[model samples]
Target: MQQLPSNSISLFCFFCMLLSSSYAKPRISSPAFAANSCNFPAIFNFGDSNSDTGGISAALYPINWPYGQTYFHMPAGRFSDGRLIIDFIAESFGLPYLSAYLDSVGTNFSHGANFATGGSTIRVPDRILPTNEGFGFSPFYLDIQLSQFMLFKSRSQMIRQRGGIYASLMPQEEYFSQALYTFDIGQNDFTADLFADMPIEKIYASVPDVINSFAYNVKSIYNSGGRSFWIHNTGPLGCYAFVFLYSPSAPALKDSAGCVKPYNELAQYFNLKLKEAVVQLRKAFPSAAFTYVDVYSIKYSLFKEPEKYGTSSVSHTTYGMEEVRINTTLH
Candidate 1:
């Protein structure tokens, strides 16, 4: 064979190196926490305003006030006073603040993406706004989040160049599955429609459908080779402002300590069923690393001992939105 030019050979080698680097796995950042050692390349957060960075802080919509005031000093689109647990988790991953999936497309997929939204629930029809107007985050489901993650992966060398268009949706036994997927949702369905005075039998009738929908969401990700997952249990709903504001009978339903027991009790039942589902999922997909993130206990602690966690002022609603102050007997 004829000898090739030295410059030509060098160019070919450089091209090959570039190609290899482009197809590498997504990168996760390290957290500053002393104890947390989680290394997630990207965090796919799917849930409500608690973990919402800006899902409710949109400019066009008539959103809530003081929702994220404490943290950003002026509603930086969060539904809390400060950084959420998911935000802290992302930091532990050594990543910058994860953006809402509704944001831009020029972001770096190599760093992972967030798919959380405010007022979002696992149910397809999230819930009716208090106006009885309509559902919020319509057509936005857990599947939408998975689809966005797939898009993020495709834009990166993680799958696009190597596997093909539907690579993320396909099995990845030959590759390292490092993406950290979290599903922290399902509170809206209860608060918006399934609450007491709404007919327990109606809720009972819909429970199976909701469970099946959630299972389908998990299975979709599973089929797409999502091996690492964190499913958050539903937070206590009885203590939330949604029920506190709308229903005057709420305080009457509370147990000692002024915490609503029946509402919390129902939440507990839903959470238990979710936990059981996760257990069955683990058995079905032994290769997957699945863990439950406890939102019930976390929210409970914050509610029961707001002084302990400094979140007593976390309560707010349309009626007493401003009147609601962050006060504690201990505080």
Candidate 2:
């Protein structure tokens, strides 16, 4: 097993690094291996709403308005008006859009399929879904989307056998190991239910358990032969639209500008916890690679510095966040 720093050492390193690099921001390497060099065949996705392209919004699950209206001109199945960080990731990989398997009626998924649904959880028996990526927040349980992904992989193999991208790319075993696996999820477990009135202590207590559950699922995928992965973590849930409206008990602070402190703090804490988890996961899964994409940072940057994104508005409600999120989602 690959060993990471203990909590104390990791904390020390984090601060030391922060102090040493305070003058410079963190550098983000490309999300993809160069198409010519990367061995992974097709990309696979798994996650909750933030990474959700259209899983829930399309199913008419009462998503916020103005979602995906900017870039898509209407809801393009994303919480935002445009593409997401994952979309950019696809582009960086020189792959085509990861069409949701649910929307794969006519699209060709030679590249891969997106199994990320809008509301999913890592461990809990989600009223939100059947597998982790819950189904439409509905009454009937849907079959595991993993089944769809397996089918897609099968077809991808056929395409390769017939001298498709697979043949064009590389051999089979290398393809499997090198294939980029993206697991973006767990935000809904923190946000959707808490906003529905779960207690704050309960939320905190559940974090480790939830992370463990997420780890279990990740192990499940690893055992199934997944290698490279993008492990997503819980989101800053209290900042969204209904959060402020429904539960005002945990009272997030705000400046004159009205930035919600409670929400931001909860988000920051979640990010910290997730960062720690990533270190642990990396240690556990050395053969397979994983990168932690801090969506919270990307999302926060867009919200804090609206000018960078070229958008005119800095709205706060879930609707506003989604609007800004849409642009961030896009290139």
Candidate 3:
């Protein structure tokens, strides 16, 4: 696939990096933590903005201020005010931050690269914006991201063999098999379908296909030497003000949390299928470790009881990445 113009691919990646330092605290006493305590040489992430370091920013335009201010003290290309979940995961593993695959200026790929972009989806959509305009859905969808990874894998090695100053930036090939492969995409697929006026039944019908596509990609990555997979289930779409407010529904249709009930139900359905997919992946890739994290439950809790989490807002509607505290018991 041809690369879209940088401006065309630019999009606003959302999601607040609200967890505290305790989220990254090591739990040595937990058997799961102890069993998986080995060092990961690198992290190769695939997703939308939820885990994007700067793929969309580098591909499209720079992420402006207020973003990265809380942590990097500058616009760091992340949608969050501070470090993202990917950053904390890197910190936990003692690995350097994963650079965006598309970033060209001053990038070091010795550790790993992020192949995620804002507005990305697991399944490629039927309609996308014209090449000259910003995309409604990212051109670098999951399949495209995988293709880029394959290309990067081979090209980085080729560049290393040439033995130039650039070679030092490439990862040693063995890192591919040992790196943690993280995913936080698929949310956009549902949102896109919803916004397109696709029938609720039709959207439900598409879930299997979406899950199958995700499985296929994971299998392909496994074939390419990836063994550790950390897949995040999609969050509650209804709780977000963007969805609930824009949706043509009465206030009565909302649940007790003031979120559109149907959207969250759809998200729950998607998560169920996703968990089933992970189970099958575990069975198929016996040697690989597939950890399916339920970020939906964690995110929904905030919306369900904002006061409980010390946040005044029930939804993440504003473009500014606000800080909201969350429990640190994430396994």
lDDT scores in order? 0.57, 0.55, 0.73
Q: Which pairs clash (backbone N, Cα, C closer than 3 Å) in model 1?
A: 28-41, 29-93, 29-94, 30-93, 30-94, 31-92, 54-77, 71-81, 313-326
Model 1 spans with C-alpha error above 4 angstroms:
1-37, 56-65, 105-108, 126-138, 155-176, 310-331
Give the worst 10-residue stretch by lDDT in candidate 3: 25-34
Candidate 3 lDDT tens digits, 75-158: 887777777788888776567888999888779899899998776888996545324432366678899999999999999999
- TM-scores for the candidates: 0.72, 0.70, 0.82
Clashes of 3: 0
Q: Report the Cα lDDT for candidate 1.
A: 0.57
Across residues 1-331, which tens digit of lDDT does each residue of candidate 2 receive?
A: 2333554223322332343344232222223222233434567777755566655544445455576666667667776666776676676555766776666344445566677766555554345333353222422112255555556556666767788434543225344455667776655555655555666677777777766666666676677677766655444454454555656664555533344656566666766776677677667866665566555655555555667777754564243112224333322
Runs in model 3 deviating more than 4 A are 1-37, 127-135, 314-331
lDDT of model 1 at residue 33?
14
TM-score of 1: 0.72
TM-score, structure 2 vs. true:
0.70
Per-candidate alpha-carbon RMSD to the true structure = 12.9, 8.4, 9.9
TM-score: the better of candidates 1 and 2: 1
Better TM-score candidate (1, 3):
3
